[model samples]
Target: MARAKNVLWIMCDQLRYDYLGCTGHPSLKTPNIDAMAKRGVLFTNAYVQSPICGPSRMSFYTGRYMRSHGSHWNGWPLRVGEPTLGDHLKKIGVRNVLVGKTHMAPDLEGMKMLGIPPESIIGVHVAECGFEPYERDDGLHPTGRPRPKYDEYLRQQGFEATNPWEHWANSGAADDGSLQNGWLLVHADKAARVPDEHSETPYMTRRAMDFISEAETDGTPWCLHLSYIKPHWPYIAPEPYASMYSTADMIPVIRSERERQNPHPVFGAYMDMRYSRNMARDDAREKVIPTYMGLISQIDDQMGVLMKFLEARGLLETTMIVFTSDHGDYLGDHWMGEKDLFHEQSAKIPLIIIDPSREADATRGTRSDALVEAIDLAPTFVDYFGGKVPAHILEGRSLLPLLRGPTPPDWRKVAFSEYDYAMQDVRLKLNQPIERCRLFMVFDGRWKYIHASGFRPMLYDLETDPQEFVDRGDDPDCAGIIARLQAELFDWALHPNDHITTPREKIAAYADNQLQVKGGILIGIWDEAELAAIRDKIDQRAKM
Candidate 1:
C-alpha cells in the first residue's frame, strides 16, 4: 500500500478516554470525535506513560517512557541529546511542526552546560520538544511568565485588557462588575467574556488549518501537531456552549464509601489536593461538570471545522489523522480531580488512528482491545512515512500492524503508567521525601497493580470492580497476584537499551573477538601444523 504523505496528529489536553459517545459515555455527546472513531481504529485500552502534561508529551514525542526521557514532571527539561519524533522524521524528509502547546520546558541549563546557544537552530528544535512551532501556545499564563501569544493576538484584535488571557478568555464578568476567574467554582456556570472564535481552541484550530494550507504547497511530507489546550482547567466556554449542558446531564460521581475508608496514604494525599478536595463537594460538581462537558463539545465542533477544511482542500484522503490526549482528568472520579494518579480516569486516554490507506479498510470503524501507550505514536508516525523504526532508541512498537486487520502475536499484554509527585507541594506538605513520592502502575486487562515508593501497593481487579473501588494490595489471598505484578513492574523498570550506545555490528564483533581470545571449547591440543596456521592467520590479521 502507498504511504500517507501527511500526518495530522490532534491532541487534546486532559480529555478523558470514555468522554466520547463511542467510548460508552451515555450523556456526553462528542459526535465529531465519534465520527472520527467510526472512520478509524479506536484503541480501547490506550494509556499514557505519565499522567502529567510535560513528561507525557515527552514520552509521546520521544517514543520513550518518561524514565527513558528523564523529564518526570512539568517544566522539567527533556535532557539534551534525546531524539524526538521530529529528529527522526526529519532524517527521512518529513517536516514536523507544532500548531499549539507542547508544554516543553527548554533545556537552558543543559544548553549552558554543553555550551550550545539556545538560539541556534538545533538548540531551538531540542527546546521545543522537536517540533518547529507554527504557533507555540502553552495556554496558561496566570502570572510570573510572559503572556501567551494568543492573548496578545486578542489584544491586537481590539479586545484590550491588562491580561486578556485571564480577564477575557478565562474569566466571567460578575453582575456587580467584578471579574471571576473561571477557576472559581462560582464562575463554572458563567460564559467566558471572550467570543467563541476568540478562545484558545478556535484560535489553535485556525492556526492548524493555516499550517495545512501552507504545507499543501510545500513539496516535503509533513506532520502537523494540532495540540488543543481545552477541556482543561480554567474550564470555561463561550456563548451557547457555556449553557449547552445542565447539571442534570453530569455523569454520576464514581466514588464509593469503600474508597474513602482507609485509603492509601499517597492516594489520600491526592484526594486532599486542592482540586480534588473542591471537586469532591456536590456543589462543585454541580457547577463545574457541565462547563467541562461544554468545553469538550466546543472541541468536537472545532474538529468538525478542521475536518471539513481538510476535506475541502483534498488533503483528507492522503493524510493520516490521529486523535488522542496526553492524559485524562479524574473529574471527581475516585474522589480525585486532576491527573497524577494511576486510576483509569487519569492514566487511560482516548486514541483513534484513521489511517487513510486501503490496508486499514478492514479495521475502520472497529475498536481494538490491544494494549497501546502514548509512546507508540512516534513510531507509528515513522512507520506511516515508510521509515524503519529506530528500535534501539524507541521503546514503543508501531501500531500500523494493529491498524490493519490482524493483531501481531507478540503485542504488549500489559499497559504501564507512572507519576512523580515529588515536586508537588502536597508531597512537601506531607513531609514525604522526593525519592519516595513516585508511583508506578502495571495493568493487564482484568487486573491492575499500583506500586508506590515508601507506601504499600494498591491493587484492583477490574473485572469484579471496574470502578476501582477496591484495593486488593493488602489482601492475603491476592498475595501471589501482587508478587507477579511486582515482578512485571521490575522487568519493565529494567530498560534494556540503557547505556548501550555502540553499534550492533561492533558489539557482535566484540563478542566474536571475546570468543576467539578465550578459545572456548577447544577440542584438542593444537598440533604443530595447526599452530603454524594460527600464527600465519594472526600475522595476516595484524598486517591488515
Candidate 2:
C-alpha cells in the first residue's frame, strides 16, 4: 500500500456524534457523510480535549491538552512558540493549508516580545495556528470581528450591508421586506436571504477546491484543513434546505424535568442561564431545531459536492479524508443550549477517517469503540507522512495502527475533555472566582466522571443511565466508583505533557552517564581509589 499523497481534513463546527445517518440519526439523511463513514473507520468513542471552540481546536492543532497549551477560552491566543500539526508536517514536506474557520487567536504579546512580525512567513503561520491561510475565516462576525474576505465576497455577489455576513448570509427576509435575524430563535424558520451558492459553506468548499488545484499544479503534498462553519450558530439554511424538514422530522429533545431539578451546582448555574432556559422551552425547540437540521443537511449536500470535485480531479484515491468536529452542540440536550459541559451531546464528537492506503482496507467500514481523542489527528497525520512521532512534543498516540492491521498494545483506556467557564455568565451566577472556574471530564467507556474545581464532582454511569438523566454525584452508594475514577483523573492530570524541552528517551539515555564526576563535580569522592574505579567504569560503559 502506498502512502497517501495528501490529506483533506474536513471539520464541521458544533456537529454532534449521533446526528448523522452513519451514527444513527433517526430522521436526518446524510448520505455523503455516511458514505465516507462506510469507506473509513467511524470512531464511536471520540472525544474532544475541550468542549469550547477555541481551546478544543488548539488541542487538535497541537496534539496537547488545553491546560498544557494555556489557551483556555475563545479569543485567547495560542502561545507563539508551541508546535502545531503544520509545524510537524512541514518538516516532512507536507504543505499545511486552511480554507475555513480555525477559531485561532494569535499570540501577539508573545510574538512582539520575540520581535516577530505578523507578515513574516513564520509569523503568518503562528498567527493562523500554523496553517498557511489560503482563506481563514473564524466565522463569528457579529459586529467587532467582521471577516473582511467573506464580507467582500458577499458584496461582490450583490448582497450589500454593513456586515453582509450578519445581514444577508445569516438573516432571512420577510414578505414585508424586513430582515429576520437568525440570531433570534423566532426567525430560525425563515430561509436565509443569501443564495445557496453564495452561502459560507459553498464559498469555503470552493476555496478548498481552488487550493487543491493550485497544490496539484505546484506538485506540493498538502494537508488542507477544509473546515466548515455551518451546522453551527445562526441556525438558518438557504433555499431548498430551509424547506427540507419540519417539526415532524425533529427528534424528541433529550432533556428531562428530573435533570432540571436540583442539578449539580455548576450544572444548575448553566441551566439557569438565558440560552439554556430559552432552549428548554418547547416553542424554541420547535422553531429552531428543524432549521438546525436543515443547516446540517445543507452541509451534507456541500460535502457531496466537495467529494465529487475531489474524485473528478483524480485526487480522491490519493487523499486521506478525515471528517470530525471541534465539539458537539447541546441543542437543548441535558438542559443546555451550547457546548460547555461534559455530556455526550457536547464533548463527544463524530470522527471518521478514510485512509486511502490498501493497508487500511481491512478496517474499512468498521466502527472502532476504542477511546479516541481530538488530539490524535496531529500525530496520525505525522505518522501517515512517515515522520517519527515526537513524544516529547506531541501528547497523543497516532491512530494509524487502529486504521491498519495491528492494533496498538497500549491503547488509551479513557477519553478526556475540559472546560473553562470564567468568561461565561455561569461563573458569575455561581459567584466563583476566575481561577476556580475549571472543569475536567474523564470517561472510561462506562463511567463518566467530571471534576469541578472547588465543587463536588459529577458522576454518571453510562452503562446504567445512558441518557444521563440521573446524576449520581451525591449518592453514597457510588463512593467506590467515584474514588477509582477520581484516582484515574488525577493520574491523567499529573502527567507532564507540557514538558517539551527534554525528550524522555534522551533523559533515559543520560541515566548513569557519570557526567558530574566527568566534569569534576563529584559530591562524595573520598579517595583516589574510588575516583579511579569510577573513571574505569565510565570508560567501560562508554565503550559498551
Candidate 3:
C-alpha cells in the first residue's frame, strides 16, 4: 500500500502574522517557521472568522462559523453532530488524535454533547507542551497556574524538573483572570530562564514525534492537532529567543493623539487609550514589545524541534505540516495589548501549509494576495484527504488554488472578518457600546468597510493610510466606494450562508446558558411586540 499520508497540524495561541520573520517582521528570529516557509506555501492575507479566542477556534475546529456551531462565546458548547477536523479524519480511514489544549469542549459538559465518554479520555496520547501544565487551581483561564500544593502532586509523580517552590513563591495575584488587567501579566523575569523540561514546546514536540513514529509503524495514517499556548501571555521563553529583540529596536510606532482618533466606534473601543492605561504606564510599553517578540521567538524554537523530528523520521516528504494561530495580539499596535476585536492587528494571522509533494518555486518566498479565511482550512484538509466537500457545511474556499497561482484569480474579490455578537467589557454593560451591533467588513487591497450594528459605517482607504488613521465614510470621493460596499454588505446580511445552523430552540437554550453563567443579560430588549415579530420571523425562517 502507498505510505499513509499523515497530517501534523501545529497551532500556536494568539500569534500574529507579522510577528514572524516569514511575515516580514524585521526583528523576528523565527528561523524554524522561516525554514518551513521555504518548503510550503505561506498565505500572506489569511484572516480569522472571529477575533476572540473561543469563537475563532470554533470556526477553525468545525470548519463552520460561530453562527453555525452554536459556540459563540467561551463556555458555550459545540452542539452534537457538528463535524470537526478530527471527526472528518475519523470519517476517512485515519486515526485522529488531539494532543494539546483543545480549548473547544475540553471540559465535561462539552464532551457529553460530542458523545465522548469521560472514560474514553484516559490512556490517550495528549499534550506535553508549554512551560508547564498551567496548574489550574483557580479554574479560570486554562493557562492559570496551580497552587504550590498542586506542585506537590507533580512531585508525587516523581517530578524532578522545577524547583516548583520558587516558581510562584512571591508572585501576587493582581487579577485572577482578566486580560483587561494587563498588569496582571507580570513581567516574567523568570520565564526567560525556565528550562527545557518545563517548557511546553519541547514536551509537545516529543509527543507529536513519538505519535508520528508509532503511527508509521502501526500502518495507520494519522492526523494530530497539536495546540501550543505560548506567546499568549506570561511572556516567558528560554534565553536566546528571550534576548532576540531589544525594547529600543522593537517598539513599532504607537498611534499619536493627532491621528483620526476614533476610526470605527467599535474599532476605536479596542484601540482606545483609556482601555490600555495599565499596559502603557511608565515604560511598560517598551518592556512589552521585546517580551512579546521573545515569546514568539521561543515558539519558533520549539517549532524547530518538531521540524527536526520530521526530517529525522523521514516523514517530512509525506506528511502535511500546518502552522497558524487562533488569533493575533494587538502587541502595542494602536495603543492596544490583547485581541478583543476585528482590527488588522488581531484579525490577521499567519497561515502556512507545507504540502510535501506540490512544488511552487515561483510562489516560494513570494507572498500571495489571495484572500483566505479561517473557515477554509478544515475543508482544505478534508479535500486533501480526497474527501467529498459538504457544500452546506462550508462557507469558505480552500487555498489550494491560490497556492497554485500567487494572485487571486479574481482581484476584485475581498475577504471578510467579524467580531462577537456582544463585545463584552465588565466595566461597561455588554450593550453599552452598542455603537455597532454587528461588525462586518469587505476589503480588497485598498479599502475596508466596517459595518456596525447601529452606528455609521467606517470606510478606510488602506492604500493612502495603511495605519487606518482617517475615516473615509464622510469623504465625497469615496462615496462611490461606500455605496458599492454598502450594497455588498446588505446583500451579505440578508442571506448569511451560515446563520445559526442548529435549531432555534437549541441556539436559544445555549444563549440562555451563557446569560446564566455570566449573571448578566447582555441581549438588548426590544419590546414584546418587536420580540413577537422577531419570533414570527424566526418561525418563518424555520419553515424555509
Say which candidate scores most in TM-score.
Answer: 2
Score residue 276 of candidate 2 by CA lDDT.
88
**How high is the lDDT of residue 209 in model 3?**
67
- Kindly give the stretch of ten consecutive residues in candidate 2 with the minimal lDDT sum: 512-521
What is the per-residue lDDT of model 1 for residues 39-134, given as tens digits with 9 covering 90 to 100?
999999999999999899999999998878889998888888888999899999999999888888888888899988888998888888889988
How far is 132's C-alpha from truth in model 2 (Å)? Answer: 0.5
Against the hidden reference, what TM-scores do the models get? 0.93, 0.96, 0.77
lDDT of 2 by residue, 247-277 (tens): 9998888888899788899999988889988
Residue 72 lDDT, candidate 1, scale 0-100: 95
**Against the true structure, candidate 3 has what lDDT?**
0.64
lDDT of candidate model 2 versus the reference: 0.89
Ranking by lDDT: 2, 1, 3
In model 2, the clashing pairs are none
Off by over 4 Å in 3: 106-186, 189-193, 259-263, 272-275, 358-362, 406-412, 421-423, 426-436, 496-544
User: 24 in model 2: Cα distance from truth in Å?
Assistant: 0.4
